[model samples]
Target: MQPTLTGRRIIQPPRSLLVRVRESVDFLARHSPARFAILVFTALILVWTLLLSLPISSHARSGTPLADALFTAVSVICVTGLSTVDMATHWSGFGNALIFIGVNIGGVGVLTLASILGLVVSRRLSLRARLMAASDSNASRIQAGPVNEGQAVRLGEVGNLLATVAFSALAIELIAAVVLLPRMLAHGYDLGHAVWYSFYYAAMAFTNTGFTPNAAGLTPFVHDYLFLGALMFAVIAGAIGFPVIFALVRLWRQPRRWSVHVKLTLFTFAVLLVAGTIMYIWLEFDNPRTFGDQNAFDTVFQSFFMSVMTRSGGFSTIDISDLHSSSLLVTDMLMFIGGGSASTAGGIKVTTLAVLFLAAFAEARGRTSMEAFGRRIPRDILRLAVSVVLWGATTVAVSSILLLHITKQSLDIVLFDVISAFATCGLSTGLTQDLPDSGVYVLAATMFMGRVGTVTLAAALAASTSRQLFRRPEERPIVG
Candidate 1:
């Protein structure tokens, strides 16, 4: 009955509607990496919300409210440590493990994980695939160009970007765990607990996320400089960005060959970190509520940690609420500056600030061009830097005003919360937990935008410049 004889070949049936839809989605994902990345994060947050809302996810018999669950999921997935509930006390082991997994997912990024998975599944990487991955990770940009050596070189860099991101993240987390495990064990934690804490803290530190698994928080380890030091190293390593880490590993001996971006990031990060440390120590030297009670070594070390953590590490060795107004203001500025671009850290970004200052410096010196690292800084980059700063500042200002209206909190406290959320820096003025649901949602949305919005805007702007074939007549306009 089937065909006693096939003089002609049987034609295959077309794919089902669902399969066709999936194929269409796959095609879209392959082309629009940034869009795909956003979708992935959104999906992750939704799934996390479902899991977190389950009764088993909580230590208490009842499940968490949907709003709180959604907020926690977003915060964890964004690697922003602002939480509606105490991570250690409010959630059970299942919740803790979920948070840990989230940190890693958000730490390395979804696009990166997807790309790595794709690499394994496909068993080959093409130039197109590399571009998509790079876009997803915000690793770098590719320009349209003729088929040439320069384009070839950039394509090669894209290939390496994916590997560098995955490798550096894992390697740093591993090293941090190894260094901190023994310290945790010595602190009287059981071997199982110690190992879990080590891995958890390592993930948090390297991701620059501020979530603490310990109910007492870092207060118990306030005097444990070894543990603190390891965390600092991990935070700095992650904050420095993957490209910088890769460069340091591959070109450690050749500082002269470093890219301008790397040089600017390093120089700016160093300047800000040192300046911040000095300022904190100076401001809080006599503030009895904070560093004034500490001994010389503790004060100095705590100030240093504060400086490093302010730039998106989100950890505090001291009670942030007790810091002097001046110290808090300084911290606000530092948090807004954030860490390096393409880093686990978030803020306006070091390179953006560096480029802005460089441009201003050049203009002040009456130079027609900006230069750094022995090369001319491109005009487009300067534009991008300015855009990022303006957007970030505007977002912070608007959010602060809205939060003030909602909570009727002091300007200082409200502004601090806003900056922290916008920078993805989890440091707070003890207000997050007390805020009304509306206020919590505001901060949650702020954190989400801070984690994804600014950078995505920058990428969109960067990729959208058109080389005009014609120009309007030049004209001068009045300016400030």
Candidate 2:
């Protein structure tokens, strides 16, 4: 019996620490999903680090160095393909399996994964959980104000969206595996090896993680057009974001019914794809180490492939370091822009670029509003886009400076790898493999911030926002 004041005695049961901890987690999941997501991703990285550090996970059957294990875990969990170790030979089958699992989980997204876990535990999505999941699809949902329904996933459709995420990933990977199976067999892999490699490559492609299992990397199949085509398709599917996929699936024939987010993402993605392809072909055409040795058709095809890979696919047929300096600059720009929002790919996202361009167009036209696809884009969105770009640029700049100082590497190479890490693009100029442990940790931090996203990180760090009852007088500052 427990003591009671001015009443009958009351009995209270003791609660275990585990229950208290779970309750606290649930509270965080309900109230502050962004912070919860950060915690979840951090926990996941630590778990993977421990797993990869195990003696059994390595080919040498000895524990991996802390720096390498931690960095690999970060890269895998972020779905970034950059690695300090020789990814193909350093890991045992168990280690590779852990990587495969980690990438898929990471690719699902932190908030969406949290919502899924909550749904599984409660047998349904609570409103807060729906909001958390919806925020993943449309980031504006995380803002303080009311979100425009036209551009966002509605609460009612969250379940279907979750199902779409899971189902589409499985279906796309299955198709890719089937298409790649024969190619693997043709390459002389045994049936079991063919099956495993087929599925592994399929997962890697769809997750936009460029880790290759074999020692030869993509060298063996550089000329395998069918295999490469399958990979390209999967990468595009992944980088387009699940929201776009959901919208496309439901409104494939109804273009007019498409949300502005979907329209902007697709249109910008196409423009960037073509632009990157042309730039690569123009810049690298005569470079002996890249396009010069290839015939006209192969050159164009490889240019297109590189264009896709730089969109955070992380796959490359040719040596990235051999590309011309100007080509590297172009790749840097493409990687900085990266792929679609809420997609497996990283960087500031193509949608952010589209918004900035639209705002510039509006300003040039002397219009007060940014209009796209017959709809007006909000001012807050423009602000958010600017913030994201600035944050991303700052992150890349700081990391580049730190890496340059740490490794004493050339600016071009350091900047390229830093942008690659920040964009999770995974394309490297042969610099990452030589980085010291400190440099590895810096790049790891860059990858984590890139994957968690600038917006999400900012939101997570913010303690709370206070609403004001009155407005302050507006002031104008001189323009640049």
Candidate 3:
């Protein structure tokens, strides 16, 4: 009996290991939200690299370099879309698949999805993840229901958040693909390729990734009524966050209660979009390569799309490199101002822009309290706005300096590339491919910064230390 019992115990190795794994998974699910996010992003890049490295990706003739894989993965996962290798020429069918996957994963935070699954099994969100999610989503409060005002979200709520993002992504991307299909198919592609192109471009465009699989993305479809409409539709939807989406839905339901953020985002977005369109049109009026021969409608349409793509989405109706110098500067400026918070787009965000602009306006008017659309802007928000602009300028300054040193290229191109990377804009002037190794490194760093975000990185560093606790009382002396 003793021998039989011992043998049975020894025979339970598989079960023991299984239990161990379950416990380990549970532990991971309950702790380390930021690290968990990093791991997920890393895994996604690996999957992308593997797919692109497959025989099918190379047309069964080997695949891209390891450096290329890592670079592409970083770009795609970050939604920067700055490719060292040409997407149209270098990657194959299988490779393009990986690129789109990266775009989707990056555009919508990966943690948003994983958090949903964890909720199903564990019924609790890790404290770290909850904080990060709250931060990333830019919500004043994460959970909608009552709780200990001191307490954060439950595991199930995290799932709800994830479901909300995923479902929104799917709905928008699918509709975009459908809208793109007919016009895209009519442009010269067969049914299969057109479908593939539509889905690829839809995912990339919807995610605001500038990566292109076809030779011409929105260029050929420049004036096509449906195509241009679809491109704008997908990209704009993405630039606006999901929370804003929910808020808008409720507003649609009731027509009276739009949140401050939603109101600000819409107003800022409209102003910028209109401003950018007109700026580009004026800048490109006679640019030979861009819109010289085009009629008024085509010129305006292309300019509008170009303006839209510069911020977050990256579909281009003309060769970005061929744009006139003035137009390039305009795009660089637009890209620096990127998309709204918690959306696929990047940058300091439109909300930040709105708040900053309001703060400026208040200062200009010599008012003590900042107000926007009759809403009182909080002091905390003002502080954040200051920090964002300071840090953003600092980052750009540093990147521009490094870029200037690394490449002998024009300062305009370097600044454009740096801002593109920092804002996660991915609009380039063909210099990304021609860049030297050092230049590549600089751009790569910017991509990482853009993806993980200036705020995330700052928070990670702050959370890792207690040094701020002992700091001397602050004093300020400034002049401008």
For all candidates in order, the CA lDDT equals: 0.82, 0.90, 0.74
**Which segments of model 3 are wrong by more than 4 Å?**
1-36, 50-56, 119-132, 139-160, 464-476
lDDT of 1 by residue, 174-211 (tens): 99999999999988899998999999999999998988
| Candidate 3: clashing pairs of residues | none
Q: Which residue runs does candidate 1 get wrong by more than 4 Å?
A: 1-14, 137-153, 458-469
TM-score of each: 0.92, 0.97, 0.85
TM-score, ranked from best to worst: 2, 1, 3
Better of 1 and 2 by TM-score: 2
* Superposition TM-score, candidate 3 onto the true structure: 0.85
RMSD of 2: 1.7
Query: Least accurate stretch of 10 residues (summed lDDT) in model 1?
Result: 144-153
- Model 3: how far is 188 from its true place, Å? 3.2
Could you tell me how far off, in angstroms, the CA of residue 7 lies in candidate 2 after the best superposition? 2.2
Highest-lDDT candidate:
2
